[model samples]
Target chain A: MNSRVVISNIVRWVLLFFVQVFLLRNIGFYNLSAPFIYVLFVLALPFGIPNLLLYILAFGTGIVMDAFYDTLGVHATACAVLAFVRISFISVTVNRDGFDEPEPSLSGMGFKWFVLYSLLCIFFHHLVVFFLEAFRLNEIGYTLVRCLLSCIFTLFLVLLAQFIFYKRKSR
Target chain B: MRNLWIFLNRYNAFFFLIIFFVAGIILTVRNNAYQRSVTLNSTNGLVGAAYEHLNVVKRYLNLGMVNDSLAKENALLKTEILALRSIDSAKDVTVKDTLRNVQYTYLPAKVIKNSFTLRNNIITINKGRLDGIEPDMAVISPQQGVIGLVRDVSDHLATIRSLLHKDTRISVAIKKNNALGSLIWGDRNFDIRKAFVTDIPNHVKMSVGDTIVTSGAGEFPIGVPVGRVRKTNVSTGDNFLAAEITLFNDFSNLQYVYVIKNKYAAEQKALELNSKNDE
Candidate 1:
């Protein structure tokens, strides 16, 4: 990645990290739905980014969140899953030769593609997060509900953020 | 060997995923001893400072309610002091209890960050090792009820494993007849205002509205309020009774808490260890 892209990604990580911890941490509805907007940073990484690097970035992001949540491994594990799924999903759907922009942002990828991408990634991430946090088989139903609700919440926040701040790249 | 090395390189990302996944599981499984990583929790200086600043605005919004509670507590303490003073002045009758000694001291601390939504909730308080706080010290609400135990300590901050956490099980007793049991959080629905009192002897009769308090078998002093029974039923597969309790403290909007320091804890622990050794 170029210097500009690298700097912008770092800035995005910092901003999303702060927003997730300071603003969204306590906003869960009845202890069920929590929006993990920080994962958007991982979801928005460029398709051309190296696979190993993406895994490291995702893990790093998750571990930082785990630190603040006092749940050291739960978030990290989930983020690692998100990175793996992202690599697999992108390879299946996106034709690299067709994209003009480096990153798979909202404006570059149409609404349908972007939504599907975020939905799948965030769903897997939230699934791992809730189930791992619960750490039980008996409470599978409760954990599933929490995971589904959180996935919807996180997906909505991610789309809102993309539409609000994402700019169309100039040729 | 060349083919094997090429295959490994081809799927290096998958291998890394497994490595990180296992590392994450190890961390989660070792959560019981997570306090060893004091630098990685909210009690860390950077995270604590941010939460402290955020709490400043949040605390301002709740000032009215906080003041009302403080006023109510002040009135109660004044009445208690007056009663004690009156008792002291009656020279004809001498009242002394050999069993009553100052055993617990309360160190007041502000809650910088608290979470009740998570299955395993933790509360970060402004006090830390510098303020003479340490792990396993009981934390209580300022309004007089159990909160949780101090789980980790840093230089200027600490994290409390709140009562709402699934792993928190406190020894408690029924107030009217002293039926002892253990206080535990929810099984399915992670309710913040309620917990379950389990393992009470089946022979003990329990009813709605009976008060529950700490059994003094743990870190908390005797008679610290825990909750009141909302419902009671016989547990299956065992001869123990369980009761649903409505907690006195609202774990959601906690502003300030007191970390209790047991003066005789070290002595008591040493004695217990000696006895165990003899056995």
Candidate 2:
């Protein structure tokens, strides 16, 4: 709700977008590797964020990515799907009271719980994204490989971001 | 209407998701040539600028390799020049066959930007209309391998519709038998494959490593190397053969390229137009 929080979120999104577009995009392990790190933007949003607002932010972020990468609507589609599923994912994992927390800070949740949550969200985002982008069942084996590799890279980056930014305050 | 708006607001994320999903499907399905051209135009500008800057760095890094390639080309050209001079002095009428057959002109230009991660891949060249590069000009590397065709040209920059693009289809033929086929991207595993060859004699033997070349049916010239046959398998319910071609040009590492201009292109086009009118 604070202006500082809003500014930080915007800055983080921009930095992630640059990294995704310029740096990570060129780091394909092979032909089948594509890491969708942009999902971290949605994953890091506050827990009680409005569903409509989340979806809009996710879509707008994706459009910026698409504009840079020249993919017309693929990122928008994937980001929207990820944002829409975030609520259900949170409900299934965390208790109702925990879900009402101010923000989805990694410090509030223990390290293991945070890792699991981030992993689930990243996996779901990459699966839908890579599958839809490929749009074929014939290469299921290849798509699966891509999904696994992307998830690994995305998980590493997402956790790194959370650990570096969300420092635990001493009680 | 009030209830509808309330319900929509309640599940607005789901509704937006549906809308975006539909939009993606529509883009995939109705990927018409014009839609592709427009997409290429939009991305070409951004990708071109980025690639141009990257090219500067890459050019410096790969200076040795580029010089090697350029030197090899220059030596070949000098040899041809000497041969032409010798033929001019000796009045051998059959020396016409010994003259270098310059079917296409090569213009040295760097790739300012390239995009392979996208569905519709494009590459921007430093040479443009000012350098005599025009739309539909066949761009190739020094190895005579097909890179792409010039799609759009400006004063000092040109956009190439790279061979990796989904909408790109070039008429190609097997070198041995001259069997015509369509070279297309399968979009599976980012491989460029050929399909739609309907009528090849069963007796014509196709072996692995057989070269594939441009069919010269369109703007492209014959003998422009496309790829080598990686695998050839017979299609079910169709007599045609499906060949997986491993493209000769390493598109990811493209640096300097030549834009080809066919001297007889206008004449050939006019003849084809008149024939169509007669028909």
Kindly list the per-residue Cα lDDT of model 2 for residues B1-279, writing each as its tens digit: 999999998767678778866765465335434445555676897889998999899779998787757845854673455345433343555656535544455567778997766667899988888888878887777655787789999999999998778777788888988988777765554643332233444556787889888888876767778788877774535666666667777776776776767655778889999999999
Per-residue lDDT of model 1, residues B173-268, tens digit only: 999998899999867757788889999998899899999999989888778898889998935468788999999889888988878888778888
Q: Please list the C-alpha lDDT of all candidates, in the order they appear.
A: 0.84, 0.73
> What CA RMSD would candidate 2 show?
22.4
In model 2 chain B, the worst 10-residue window by lDDT is: B191-200
User: Candidate 2 has which clashing residue pairs, if any?
Assistant: B51-B112, B51-B113, B52-B112
CA RMSD of each candidate after superposition? 23.2, 22.4
Off by over 4 Å in 1: A96-99, A167-171, B32-279
Cα lDDT, model 1, residue B32? 27
- Spell out the clash pairs found in candidate 1: none
lDDT at B273, model 2? 97
Per-residue lDDT of candidate 2, residues A1-171 (tens digit): 488779978898889888888898888888767777888888888776777788778877877776776665667777777876777777677776746456676777778877887787777777877776666578999999999888888888888877777775513
Which docking band does candidate 1 fall into? acceptable
